[model samples]
Target: MTQPRIVLYSALLCPFAHRARIALKASGAVYETVEIDLKNKPAWYAPNINPASKVPAISYGAPPDSDVTKPPAGTFLLPESALVVQFIASLYPQIDYKDPIIRAKASFAQLQWDNLVAGRWRKYQFEGSEQDLEPLLEGLKQFSDSVPEEILGDEYGVADIILGPFVTRLFIFANEDIGKWAPGSGPKLVSALSGPEYDKLRKLGAKLDKWPALQETIDNDILVKKFTEILKNH
Candidate 1:
């Protein structure tokens, strides 16, 4: 079967969009990336594509439109980065989604990480206050303790996918700026998430050697790039 032609509408600075890129790359999906200038969105981005005018929208084609749902030719448009990533995973189950039950469980884990942990992490990243990360880290510690190990048993799943980027960033920022402020926070975060199965995941995340796909993005440069674009104008 021919590979699917996927066009991902993305911004380098958006972590949400990065999730889509990671999913596609990790799943081995053949995709073309369209970098959107989020500061000044393109003319085609409105009602024609995504009504929400968000980055990480997607248009997928080819593979002869299997039993699965597919978008109309040139009419394909999907918004929301998380959903787009999940949809791509669903398309290539062998690479990403695996089984229906496993997929569902992974999806739930992704949702929990996104809505709970990620949301809290963002509150710290943007706020310019080290104090805020404390409560969030505590919450994470509690979460790690409570969540069953069986949830992350023996395999990488949506939990790792969803949490990897931010956790990586947290590890980075904490080491750089806040590690001394909260000495145990960074190590605790790492230990909580990095089990034996997630060993590969830990390396994939914050390795001194940059992940090939993200080399152009720099070492934690998204934060700088985004702040430069958004904050400079404002």
Candidate 2:
């Protein structure tokens, strides 16, 4: 079976876009990458590609060099990182979610992370709270506890691709004790998340670090510096 021509419009710093890159690399798909500058986007990007002007967009069934901006009608233009990653997985099932059980676990993990963990993660980092890290920590504990058995086991599926990058950042922030949170908050978060209770989550981040896609897609030191910039502005 031949893979469709794919051009990934991505940004290195965006966690959402990072999921697409991980999926692409894990699937071994041959695709051209057009790195997008989120700050200074291309003039052609919004109208020609994603009207929302977001990274991790995909233009399929279009020539990689066609018109540079005007992707012809009928090109399957896809936006949003979760959908994009699933689309790639659908195209190459062998690489991800090939088993129904794996799919179920992925869905479960996604829900738990979004409902329990995601929002608190943002709040803890970008806004000051007397609660400090408690909100984020509690959310993480529940998220970890709710995951299905073997979710962090031998298989790497959609859950890992979608959530791993952000989780990795959390680990880094906690270890370095950096961010908009209180000065010592970083080490506190890391210490708790690293305890045996969160071992599965730790394993997930470890795998992300060891993955081939992650070698270039994720840089810990760079991300720490990047988040420093973001949190300072808040």
Candidate 3:
């Protein structure tokens, strides 16, 4: 099946948008990208593409010469990073979720990491409370343990596509000491991840960094600088 022509509304620094970028890149899809300025979004953005005015939105099936602010009738407008990734993956014939077993495994992988991420991110990454440190490490250990080898098997499928951005960001931010973490908490998190407990996740993160798609989308220096600036509530 032919995938629709996609105009991705994205911001380079956004992890959410990076998910879509990875999916699109890995799928070998031919899509145009419109980098959105998240700070001062264009006037046409919200009404034309995503009502939430967020990055990681897509304008699907619009013609090459189509007006962005007013796409022709039947143009499919989609928002949210995960959904966009899923939609793109669904179109590609190679990344199979058709088999019931694969389907179930994918669902479980996504759910497990999704729940874990939501529970731990704010406390550990952003707020970086001293008390929240151990809990976050425990959660990551659970995540690494649950990651089936088959989930991230030969092909980089939806599971990897969805989780790659966050995991990569987590590793980079932790190691670079970039975030609003309490004094010494960032280094502690970094040190803990360097230990034997996180060997699985650490290896997985390194593997992701090697992927051309992820490598292209993620610039380690840029991420460190960009996130550090953003985290400065100073």
Best by lDDT: 2
Measure candidate 2: CA RMSD: 1.9
Off-target runs (Cα >4 Å) in candidate 2 are none
Q: CA lDDT, every prediction? A: 0.60, 0.80, 0.78
TM-score to true structure, per model: 0.68, 0.91, 0.89
Candidate closer to the true structure by TM-score (higher is better), 1 or 2:
2
In candidate 1, residue 68 scores what lDDT? 21
Which lDDT tens digits does candidate 2 get at residues 43-81?
999999999999889988886558646789989899999
lDDT of 3 at 171: 71
Q: Write the per-residue lDDT of candidate 1 for residues 1-234, one digit (tens) a residue.
A: 776567778887676787777777767777777788888987767655687888778876734443122345555578987688678768866446456676665566555565666767666544535677666766555444433344344455554555555655666665444333344554555565566544433443544234444343334665645554553454
Candidate 2 pairs with clashing backbones: 177-186
Candidate 2 positional error at 105, Å: 2.3
For model 3, what is the error of residue 149's alpha carbon versus the real structure, in angstroms, after optimal superposition? 1.8
Give the Å error, residue 64, model 3.
1.5
What lDDT would candidate 3 get against the real structure? 0.78
Candidates sorted by TM-score, best first:
2, 3, 1
